[model samples]
Target chain A: MNRRLLLVSNSTLYGGGYLQHCQQNISDFFGKQVKRILFVPYALHDWDQYTKTARDKLNSLGYEVDSVHEAADPVKAVRKAEAIFIGGGNTFRLLKALYDNNLVTEIRKRVLQDGVPYMGSSAGTNVATVSINTTNDMPIIYPPSFSAIGLVPFNINPHYLDHDPNSRHMGETREQRITQYHEELNTPCVLGLREGSLLLVEGNTATLLGTTNARLFQRGKQTSEHEPGTDLSFLLTDAQ
Target chain B: MNRRLLLVSNSTLYGGGYLQHCQQNISDFFGKQVKRILFVPYALHDWDQYTKTARDKLNSLGYEVDSVHEAADPVKAVRKAEAIFIGGGNTFRLLKALYDNNLVTEIRKRVLQDGVPYMGSSAGTNVATVSINTTNDMPIIYPPSFSAIGLVPFNINPHYLDHDPNSRHMGETREQRITQYHEELNTPCVLGLREGSLLLVEGNTATLLGTTNARLFQRGKQTSEHEPGTDLSFLLTDAQ
Candidate 1:
C-alpha cells in the first residue's frame, strides 16, 4: 500500500495555540508541493466553525484549506484534493459522518492509491487506523460500523495518559483499557500516543515524531515505551 | 411498568473493598425477602473469579449469591431469580455477552414486568439505561446494538469526574462528553454518576443516593446538581 499519513495525538496542547505543537511537522510533511488541503470536520457538531478553526490555523502555517462540508460533491472533492486533514471531536460522530457521506472508501483511495498526504488529530488519528475501538472519545452516536479507513495496520489511542498514582478515581486507567482491548483482539497492536506525540508514515516506514514518548501494547508481551524519533515502521510491516 | 433498580456508579471506590461502598444499600434494597441474589459477572473477563468476589462480598452482607454464568440456561436463571446483581467491568463486553446469550429481553422483563429487584455497578449500571452510548468503557468488542435494557428511561455515565481547573489534559471532560451525547439524542437524558453515588428506584420514583451529588444533563437544559436525597423521579416519569 502507498500511504503517507501524519497522525497526531492532539490538535491543541496545553499552553499552546491550536495545532501549534505540531505546526512545523505538518508543514514539513505536506511540503512545498502541496498548497490547498481538504479539511474534514465531521467529527464535530458545527462543521463550519471547525473548518474555520482549521483554516485559520493552517493559513498561519502557509496553506489553504477547502472544507469537505462546503463541497457539493464530497467524493469528487476527495479525488481532487492535494492533501487531506481531519480534525478531532467525537470519534463515533466522525465515523458515522464518514459512512453517512460515503467518504470512507474515497478517502482511503486518495491516501493509499493516490498517495495524497493525510493528516489527522485525535479522533482523526483514530479513524486512520484499523478501527476506532481504541478511541478515548465517547460513543455519543452509533456509527454503522466500528471499522475505519485502515491506513495503518495497528490501532492508535490518541491523547493517551498514564495511570495517575495520586488520583482517587476508580475508572480503569488507559493502560488497563488497552489491556482489555488486547483481551478482545490480540493482534493489531495498540499504540498509545501521549499529547505532543505523532506518527509520520511515509510508504511502509513510520517514525515516531514530536517531543513525547509512545506506549505500545501487544498480546503476550510486556507493555513497551518508545521515545520520539524511534522507528515504528515495524508496526506497518505486516497487515493484521 | 413496575421497576426497582439500584444503579451504582462503581463496584469499588478508592480505599475501599469490592462493593464495600454500596453494600449497605445493596442489603437494604434486596431486603429480607430476597435471600439468594443472581450475579451476572459477564461484564468482566474472568467470570468465575468475578462470581467468587461477588459471592464472598454478598455473603458477608447476609445474602446468598448465585452467578448466572454457572447456570446451564442463563435466561432461565434470570427468569427464576429473586434479585439480580450485575457487577462492573467493560461495558462493551457485558452488552455483547447479553446479546449473545439473548438476555437483554429476559433481564428487562424480569425487572420491569416481574418486578424483580435489579442491582448494578459501573458497566452494570450502563446496561440498565436506554443505551450504552454514555458509558466510559472502550469499544473493545462491538455488540449487535448500542441499545441496552431500558430499566430506566435515561442513559448513564459511570465514574463521572468533574473538570479539574488545574489539569492540562485536553481530552473532553465528562460533562463535555455528555453534552455531545445530548447533541446526538437529547430526549433521553444522560445522568453522570460520580464515584460512590447510586440511583435508587422503586416503582416510578427514583432518588439519588450515596455521599456525593449527581449531575444531570438534559437537552436544552442547564446541567443541574442534585443532592443525595433529591427526588429524581421525574427522570422515570415518562417513557422515552
Candidate 2:
C-alpha cells in the first residue's frame, strides 16, 4: 500500500534509446530503494518489446516489474506497487488507454493523495497535465484530442530539449508547437523537458530535474529559462 | 469575392484585453490594402466588443468588415466575403462555427484554392492546424472540440514568448509541454511562436513570419531551432 511513482521520459529498451543517463538519474535522483517498477505500455513502443525490455531492466535493477493493462487498474497497481515508471510511446494511445481504463483519475489520486513517489517519462510526464495538448503527438486518425489527467495543474511537453545533432528530420520546432499551446490558453504553465529531464511534483511543489535547459511559459509570456536547479513550481505557487 | 485571411491568437479584445496584440498586429503587419476584414471570435469573448473593434479597424484601414455572424443568414457568407481578417479569440469556437456554418470547406477553397492571402494573429493562427488540440486553450471545459480548416498540418501554440513577469502558477515549463508533445507523437509539429511571430502556410509551404524563434520536434528529439529568418514547412512538409 506504500508506493512511489517513477516516470521515465524514454525507455532504455527502445531503439536508439538513451539508457545510461536515464538510469543514473533514476537511481541517484530517486531513492535506490525503488523495489517495484510498473510500465504503462500505453505509451510504449511495440507493447511486447516495451514490456520485455522493461521487465529485463527492472529485473536488473533488482525490482519487480508490472505492466498495467487493466481496464480500471491504475489505482490498484499504484496501491500495491512501490515505484511506478511510465514509459514513452504514443501519448494519445497511452492517454486513451488511461481514460478508457479510467486510470487517469486513479493516477491523480495515487500521486496527489497517496504521494506515490512518481516517475513519469515523456508521455508519462504528459499525463500530469490538465490536458495533453502540450504533447507533440499529432492526433491524426482518432481523437487523443486535448484531454489530460490534470495530475499537475500545468501541461507537460516531453523530449523538450534543443535539436539533436545526430538526427536530420526538421519538424515544427518545440517552441513553435508550444507557442500553439500558449496561443490557446497561456495561463497554464507549459514544461519542456529534455531526454533525461524530470519534473518532480511533490506535495504542493513541482521541481525540474534534468541536466539540460527547459523553457517555462505562461499564457503569452515566457518566464525564465530553467536548468536542473530550477524550482519548477516556485513562481507557480507564488502566483497562485 | 476576393478576400484576405487574417489569423489572430488572443480572443479578448479592447482595453488591454487578452488579445491586445490582435488589432495592432493586423494594422502594423498588413497595410491598408486589405480590402475587407472578417473577424473570427473563437475563444468565447464578447461578440459586440470583437465586432466593434474589428469594424473600427477595418474602417481605419479603409475596408469593409463583417463579423461572419452577419452572413449567418444565408451561410453563403463565405462566398460573399472579400478579404477575411480573423481576429484573435477562441480558435476552437471559431473552427466549430466554421464547420457548423459550412465555412471551413469554403475557407479552404478561397484561401488554398483561390490564393487568398490568409493572415492571422493568435488563436486565428492556431485553427489553421489539422486539428484543434495544438491550441493553448485550457481543456477544463471541453468546447465543441473539432478539427481546424486543415490549412496546415500541425496545430499552432501561439503568443509563445516566455513566462509572465507578474503572476504565479506552475507545473510543467513551456519546454516540458512541447517535449511531452514530441515524446507522444511521431509527426505532430508544435509551433512555438512569440507575440509577433507567425507560421504562414501558403499552398503547402509554411513560412515563418515574425521576429522570434521557432522550434521543430519529433519523437523525443528536437529537430531545429529557427530564428525569425527561417523558412517553415521545409522539414514539416517532408515529414507529412
Candidate 3:
C-alpha cells in the first residue's frame, strides 16, 4: 500500500493560533516533494473565509495553497495536485459536498494509488476512516451515505474528550457514545484522538504523534492508551 | 389535528430514579382512556431489558404495558394499541428499527389521526420531529433517511445542555452543533429541551411542562429561552 497520510485530531489547539502547533509536522510531511496543495474547504460553512485562512497559514510555510472549489473540474484539480489538505468543520457537510460533487472515488484513487500526500483535521480526518458513524458532528445534512474514503482501516473519533466525573450534564459522554457504537457495530476499532495528537502514516507504518496519549477502543475489551512515538501500524492490518 | 403527544428530554434526571420525576405527568396524560400501552424498545441495546423496565414503570402508573417486538405482527399491534411509548437510547438504531419494521407511517397515523396518545423520551422525542437531524446521539447506524414521522413541524434536540464556560475541550458545544444544523437547513426550528423538561401537546395546544427553561433555535436569529408553563403550541403550526 503506497499511502502517505497526516490525520490530525484538530487544526488548532485550545487557546492557540490556527494550525500553529502542527506547522513543523506539516512542513516535514510535505517537504520539497509537494509544492502546490489542493485545499478542500467543503467541511466549513464559509468556504471562502476558510480557504483564505488556510492559504495564509500554508503560504507562511512557502507552499502554494489553492481551494478545489475554484477549479473548473474538481476531479481534474484533485488528480493534478501534488498534495491535498482538508480543513475541519462539520463532517456531514463535508461528506455531502464530496458526494454531491462526485469526488470521493477520485480523491481516494489519488491518495491511495497515486501516493498523493493527504492531510486532514477534525471533520477532514473523519472521512479517512471506514465510516463517519463515530463522528461527533450533528446530522446537519443527509449525505448520500456514511461511507467515507478508506484511507485507514479504523474509524477516527477526532477531538475526543474524557468524561467529566464532576459535571452534572446528563448527556452520554464520548466514551459511552463510542461504547454504544461498538455494541451496535463491533468490528472496526475506534481511535479516540485527543487535541494536539495526530496519526502519521507512511506506507505501512503508522505512528502516533503528540505529547498526549491516544485512547484505543475495541469491542468487548477495555480501552487502552498509547503515548506519542508508538508504532500503531498494526491497526492498518485487516486481521484486527 | 387531534394530536396528543408527550416529548420528554430524558427518561430520568441526573442521580434520579428511572422515570421517577415524570410518573405523575405520565399518569395524568394517559388517565383512564389508554389502558394498554405499546412500548418501542428499539433504541436500546437490550430490548428485553428495556421493555421489562418500561413495563414495570408504566405498570406502576396503572397501565398495561407491552413491547411491540413481542407481537406476532408489529404493524397490527401498533394499530390496535391504545397508546404508544418510545424509550430512550440511540436515536439511529431506533429510527433504523422503525424503518425496518415499516412502522413510521403506522405510528404517524395512530398519533396524528386516530388520537392515540404518543409519548417519547430522548431518542423517542427525536423521532417525533420532522427529521432526526438535531439529535444528540451518535450515528451508530444509518437509517433509510434523516426524515422522521413529522408529528411536529420542526425538530427536537433532546437532552440539550449549555456550554461550560471554563472547559478546555476543543469539540463543538451543543449550541454550536445546533447552529451548524441551522446553517445547512435553515427552515426548521429546533427545540433544545433540557433534562426534566417536556412538551405536552393536546390538539392544537402545546404546553411546556417542568421546572427548567427550554431553548429555541431559529436560523440566523438569536436563540431564546422559554420557561416551563409557557404556551409553545405555535410550534405545531407550519407557518414558522
Candidate 4:
C-alpha cells in the first residue's frame, strides 16, 4: 500500500483562479520526481479546452502535461505514465470514458500496484473512492457502472455543503441525500469534503488537508467533524 | 392520444404541510371520476408508512387509497387501476422497483392507452419523463437503465432550484447540470418545475398549473421562464 494520492474537493474556489488554491500542494505531492503527467479530462464535455487549461496550469508549476485522449492507446499510456491527473466535470461522464477506453484497471494498477502518483479534483477525486454513489453531479450520461477505481476504502462526497437555514428551496439538503445513500448502503462511511478541503494519502496514512473541517457520516452513528491536519489513516483500513 | 397526467414538482412547499398546498389542484384534477386510487409507494424506503400517510391524506379528500404493494399481482393491479399516484422519494429506487416489477410498460399502457389518470410528485414526476436523467434525488441504487416510463415526450426536473448568488459552494448549479445533459442529449426538452408548480395534461393539451413560473431548457436555445397558466401542450408533442 505505497500508493500516493491527492484527492481535492474542488479545482477552484469561489472567486479564485483555476487550480490556484491547490497549486502549491500539487507541486509538493508530485515533487521533482514527476516531470511529465497524464491528464484525464473526460469528465468535461470540451476535452481540448479542458486539457489545454490543465496543461497550462501544470506547465506553470514546472510539470509537462499530456492528455490521455491524444494517445493512440489509452491503456498503454496509463501503464507508462509517470503520474496521473484527472480533472473535474461530471462524474458519470468521467467514469464512462474510463470504462469506454478500458483504462479503469490500467490506471488502478499504475496508481496502487506500481505506486504512481495520482491526483484528482471534483469528479477526478470522486472516482478514487470505492464508488461514485456519493457524487453531487447529475447523471448526464450513464456509465457502465457506478463502481470506480476503489483506490480508497470509504466513499468521498466532494464539494460538500452545509444547509442554509434561510433557504426557501424544497430540494433535499446535502446531508439528507447522503443519508438516503446510507439507507441503501449502511457499510461504507461517507466523507463530506467541502470546497478547499482535500484528502492526502500515502501508503496506509490518510491526512485531512485544507482550511475547513471535513464531516464524516457512518450508518447508525452521529456525524463527526474533523479539523485540518487530523490523521485519518484509520479510515484507509475501515470496511468498504 | 387520450392521456391524463398531473406532474407535481414537490409534495410539500417551503413552509406548508405535506401535500397541503396541492390538495385543491389534486381534487380539481381528479374531480368525481376517481374514487379508488392506486398508490405507488416504491420510491419511499418505508412503503407501509408512506402508504399510510398518503392514504390518510387522500381519505380526507374523499378518495380511498390502496397501495400497489398490497396487491397480489402488481401488473394486473395497474391494468384495472382507476387512477394512479406515485409519491416522491429517491428516483433511483422508484425506477428500480418499476423495472423489477415489470410495471413500466404496464403503467404507461394504462395511462396512455386506457386513459387512466396518472399523478406523480418529485421522483414520481421524474419517472414520467422519457428518462430520469434530470432528477434531483441521489442515485442510492442503480436501475436496469436510465430509461423511464416515457409517459411524456420530454424530461421533468422536479424540485428545480435557482442558484444562490451569495453562496460559496463550488458544486455545479442545477441549470449547469441540465446543460451538461443537453450536451449529450440534444433532442429532448427539459422542464425545471419549481416547488408549488405543476403541469396538468389531458389528451394532447398540457397546461402549467401553479403560482410560480417554470423554467424550460432546450438544446441550442436560451432557458426560458413561463408563468403559471401558460399553455405547455407543445412540449407534449416534442421529441423524447
Candidate 5:
C-alpha cells in the first residue's frame, strides 16, 4: 500500500483566491519530479470551466494539466498520468462520471498500486475515502454506487462546520450527521475535515495539515480532535 | 389526482418542542374524520422512541398513533391507514427502509389513490416528492435508487436556510445546491422549505403555509420566493 494522497478540505478558503492557501503545499507534494497532472472535473457541471480553473492554478505551481474529459481514452490517460487530481463540486455527479468513464478501477490502481500522486478537494476529497456517504453536497445526480475510490480506509466529511451556539437553524449538525452514519456503519471512522484543513497520506501514515484541528468519529467511541502535526496512522491500520 | 399532503420543513422550530410549531396545521390537515395515524419512524435510529414521541404529540391533537414498526405486516398497515405521518431524522435511512419493506408503492397508493391524508417533516417531507435528491440529510446508507415515492411532481428541500453573508463557511449554499440540481435535471422544480414552514396540498392546489416564504428553483430561470397562501399549483401540474 504505497498510496500517496493530499486530500484537501476545500479548493478555496473563505477569503482566499482559487488554490491560494494550498499553493505551497501543492508545490511541495508534487515537487519538481511531477510536471503534469491528470484532472478529473466531473464533480462540477462545466467540465471545461472546472478544468481551466484547475489548470491555471496548477500551472502557477509549475505543472501542466490534462483533463480526463478532454482525453479520447480516459482509462489510457489515467494509466499514463504522472499524477491525478479531482476537483470539488457535486459528489454524486463526480462519482457517476467516474463510473461512466470506467475510471474508478484505473484511478484506484494508479493511486494504490502505481503510487501515483493523488490529490482532491471537497467532493474530490470525499470520493477518495471509503465512500461519498459523508459528503455535504446534494444528491443532484445518482451515481451507480456510493462506493468511492477507497484511497483511504476511512470516510471523510469535507468542509465540516461546527454548530454555532447562536444558529437558529434546526438541521442536523456536522457531528450529529457523522454520529448517524456510525449508527449504520460500524467500521471505518469518519474524519470531519474543517475548511482550510487537509490530510497528507504517505503509505500507511496520514498526518493532519493546516492550522485548524480535524475531528475524528468512530463507532461506539468518543470523537477526538487532532492537531496539524498529529500522526493518524491508526486510521490506515486494518483495525476494522 | 386526489392526493392531499402536509409536507413540513422541520418537526420542531429552533426554540419549539417536537412538532410544536405545526400542531395547528396538523390538526387542520387530519381533521375530525381521520382518527388513527399510521406512523413511519424509519428515519430515526430508534423506531420505538421515535414512535413514542410522535404518538405522544399527535395524541394531544386527538389522533391515535399506530407505528408501522409494530405491525404484523407493514404493507397492510399502510393499506389500512386513515392517515400517514413520517417523522424526520435521516432521509437515506428512511427511503432505504421504505424500499426494504416494500412500503413505497403501498404508501403512495394510499396517499394518491385513496386520498388518505399524508404528513411528513424534514426527511419525511423530502421523501414525499419526486425524489429525495434535494434533502439536507446525509446519505448514511444507500438505497437501491435515488427515485423516491412520486406523490408530487417536484422535489422538496426541507429545513432550507438562506445563506448568511457574514458566515465564513465556504460550503455550497442551499441555493447553489438546488441550482446544481437544475443543471442535471431539467424538470420537477425544487421547493426550498424553511423551518416553521410547510406546503398544504389538496388535489391540484398546493398552498404555502407557515411564517416564512418558500424558495422555488426552476431550470434556466431565476429562483422565486412564495409567501404564505400563495398557490403553488403550477408545481403539481404535468408541465414538466
Candidate 6:
C-alpha cells in the first residue's frame, strides 16, 4: 500500500496510438523503478486493446501490467504495484464501473492515504474532480453515480475550447456554461484546461505542469488565469 | 428619434408570423390613446414578410407599419413610429442585419435616450442583453455579428430549463451552461428565467414578472432564487 502510482486518461485517443500524458511525466513522480502496473480500460470499446497498449507502456517502463476486469481484485493486484496507472477512455463508463466495483475508493486510498504517487490523464484526470461539469461528452450518458474519486475538489471542463466563432449554429458559449455551473454549485470550482496541460498535486504542492493554459472561475469573483508552470496547490483549497 | 418604444421577438414563429408581441402590449405602455402602433419584424427570413407583417400589425393597432429594408429606411421608420416593437427570432441573424443596416444604433436612440419601453421575448429577449450568451441553440449556425441592442446588462438564458429531463445529450446542463458564463464575467448576472418569467426594466426600474421561477446567480456567491408574483424592482440600480 505504500508506493507510487499513475492514473492516465484515454478519452481522446484516436484509434490505436501510443500513450499520452500518462507517459509524459509519470516517471518523474514514481521514479524509474515502477512495477506491477494495473490498467483500467473501462473507457475504451474493446478493453483488450487498451489494456494491451497500457501493458506495453508499463512494460517499457519495466513494470508488469495486469488487466483488471474485476473491481474486487484491484487493490489485491495493486498492493504490490510500484505504481498504479488507470488508463482513460470514456469517462462516464469508467467512473460507473469504478463506482459499481468500489475500486475508486481503493484507488483513492492507495494514492492519498497509502501515499502512493498517483498520476491521472484525461478521463482519468476527470475522475479526480468532484464532478464532470467541464467534460465535452454529452450529459446524456448519466452514470448511476455523480461522484468521482474526489481527489480534487472541482469540476473539470475537458476539451475546453471547441467553440469556433465561424460556425453558424447559435448555441451556448463556453463562458455561459461556467455561469450555469455557478447557478447550481456554491462550492465546486470549474477548471477550464486545454489539452497538454496537467494539474499535479503532491501532498502540499499543487502544480500546473504541461504546455497549455489553465483558467479557474468561481461565483462573485473575476476569473483567475494560470499560465503553464504555475503552482496550483493554493487553488485546491479555494477550488473546493 | 426621441420617443417611447417597445421591441418584441419573433424568432420563434419559424418564418414570420402575422401576430407579434409588439401589438399585444402596445396600449398598456403607450396609454389609452394608443393610436399609432409600429411593428418591426427585423427577424423575418424574407425582407418582404418582415415588411408585410409590420404593415399588417400596425394597421391592426390603428397605426402605420413601414418597411425599413433600405439602408436609411429603418432610421426614418423608427422616426415615424410612435411605439416600436422589435420582434424576435434568431437574434444573431436579426441583430446582425440590424447592425449591418445601421438600424440598431437608430433603435437605441429611440429607446434608451428617447425613453422607448422596449419589450422583447426569446431572441427578442436576447438582443436586449449586452451579449447573447444565454441562447439554447447549438453552434450549427453562426451569426455574422454578436452585439445586441443593449437594453440590459448580463445574459438571459431564456427557456431556462429544458422541459424534459429524461433525454440525455452532450451539452451543458442549464446550471452548468450558466456557470460557464461566470468563468468569464463576475458582475454581469446570468438570469435563468423559465418561460413565463421576465425581467422588465422600465426607466431604471427592472421588475421580474410572470408565473414561474427565475434564478439569479452572482459570481462567488451560491445562487439566489426568486419566484413569480413578486416584484423585481428591488434589484434595479437605476431608480425611476
Give lDDT per model, in order: 0.92, 0.59, 0.91, 0.91, 0.92, 0.58
Model 2 complex DockQ against the native:
0.06
The Cα error of candidate 4 at residue A14, in Å, is: 1.2
Model 1, residue A26: distance off in Å is 0.7
Segments in model 5 whose C-alpha atoms lie over 4 Å from true places: none
* Better candidate number, 2 or 4, judged by TM-score: 4
Please give each candidate's TM-score: 0.98, 0.56, 0.98, 0.98, 0.99, 0.49
DockQ of each: 0.85, 0.06, 0.82, 0.82, 0.90, 0.02
The C-alpha RMSD of each candidate to the native structure, in angstroms, is: 1.2, 9.9, 1.1, 1.2, 1.0, 17.3
The worst-scoring run of ten residues by lDDT in candidate 3 chain A lies at: A179-188
lDDT of 6 at B141: 23
Best by DockQ: 5
How far in Å is the alpha carbon of A111 misplaced in model 2?
A: 1.8
Tell me the tens digit of each residue's lDDT in model 1 across B71-106. 999999998999999889999999999999999999
- Residue-level lDDT of model 4, residues A37-68, one tens digit each, is 99999999999999999999999999999899
TM-score of chain B of 3: 0.98
Error of 2 at B138 (Å): 12
Candidate 3's residue-wise lDDT over B1-240, tens digit each? Answer: 889999999998988878888888998999988889999999989999999999998888899998999999999999999999998999999999999999999999999999999999999999999999999888989899999988999998988888889988888889989988888745599999999899999999999998699999988789899999999988888876
* Candidate 4, superposed: residue stretches over 4 Å from native: none
Which residue pairs show backbone clashes in model 1?
none
Per-residue lDDT for B1-240 in model 6, tens only? 233323222222223244432334544556656455455565545667666655665576666554556426667877666565666554545666677667777877777787755556666677777666555532112344455676665667666764346532223357765654554433367677765556656665555655567888666668777875456545434221
- Local lDDT at A97 for model 2: 75
Q: Could you tell me the lDDT of residue A211 within candidate 2?
A: 59
lDDT, residue B71, model 6: 27
Model 1 per-residue lDDT tens digits across residues A57-154: 99988899999999999988998999999999999999999999999999999999999999999999999999999999887788999999999988
